[model samples]
Target: MEFSAADPGTVRPGGRTARVRAAVLRAAGDTLAERGFAHLDLADIARRAEVGRTTVYRRWGTVTGLVADLLADMAEQSLPRTETGSLLGDLKANARLVQRTLADPRQGALFKAVIAAATCESKTAAALHRFYDTRVKEWAPCVQQAVDRGEVPAGTDVHEVIRAVSAPLYYRLLTCGDGLDEAAADRAAEAAATAARAGVYVLG
Candidate 1:
């Protein structure tokens, strides 16, 4: 099943399998955050998760598979999009969520590890793309609603507009050492809203 950032309605089987998956994924996240993707090892992850190496190797097969599953689980567990009845408000909410996630020491490190791996790993890159696709789809409706309310022009690319709200925040994380703050999130929101209203995101 394709994992989604919005509630994808947990198709994962429950009970022991779910418990093992959760434990494994959590351990994988911790390893990525602390050691980077280059150092990720299925045996190490199994040890960290307190599961048998045979189970991890049998289930995931490779480090790439484990990382892909971890990202999928993350997308599944991600918070749902916030609806605030206004484009700016919705964008701000989205931006703030991104900021908070990237600003956290562990989460930020984990993302960095995945991104680093994605640079050289096609499979990891594809999984990363899917993760963002799911997140964008989750928030795209907010911009559509804004269009319906006449806040943006017809044919505006709502998904791109929503993505714009988070772009600068992500850029800052990758490029600068500055602290991510609420002000930055609000500014990102305002800029995206202004750009959308000015037809910048309007599809040609």
Candidate 2:
């Protein structure tokens, strides 16, 4: 499970504005990973990004605003679903991707900070939900393809199956101190694939 160069809080797009956005977002993620969300300051972030503080404040009025943009950039930069041509393989790909992300120290810490911030802020919470929604949507087609191939029951909740694959891994990240490993990723993928095959995700 190799971590991506760009995580959910990191995005590198083309052009000047995109470049500034990526720099600022990267600095923001680094800050959050190091100091948590409570200590996030726009001026400090600007300094870290080597961008003008006025530019950051003018573009993003608040920390939450900047976080929202970071999340949008992350979704924009996230890798597309891998088509392994089979449900199990596709799910394993997805699981391994998630496992690597949570296993990375910086990404794991940044996500923890963002999730903690979301717990107390409505706007941040909404943005976090949207972020996960975008990721789930990106992978839902794999489940749909599985259905087309007669691997799962019709009317299976594609979103549920996808979420199921990541739920336990996240729980482990947040709770257990055990390192996120490839074996855990494989188990998650297998469990989700098994449940999907059993019609556990079928809508009533």
Per-model TM-score, in order, reads: 0.93, 0.94
Model 2 vs. true fold: TM: 0.94
The Cα error of candidate 2 at residue 61, in Å, is: 0.4
- What TM-score does model 1 achieve against the real structure? 0.93
Provide the lDDT at 39 for model 1. 93
Query: Between which residue pairs do clashes occur in model 1?
Result: none
Residues 18-38 of candidate 2 have per-residue lDDT tens digits of: 777778888988999999999
Question: Which residues of candidate 2, in runs, are more than 4 Å off?
Answer: 1-13
- Which residue window of length 10 is worst by lDDT in model 1? 1-10
Candidate 1: Cα lDDT at 112:
84
CA shift of 49, model 1, Å: 0.4
**lDDT per residue as tens, model 1, 1-204:** 111132222456689878788788888888888999999999999999899999999999999998888888778677888889999998988988888888878887888899889999999999988888878888899899999999999999998998898888878888993768889988999999999999999888
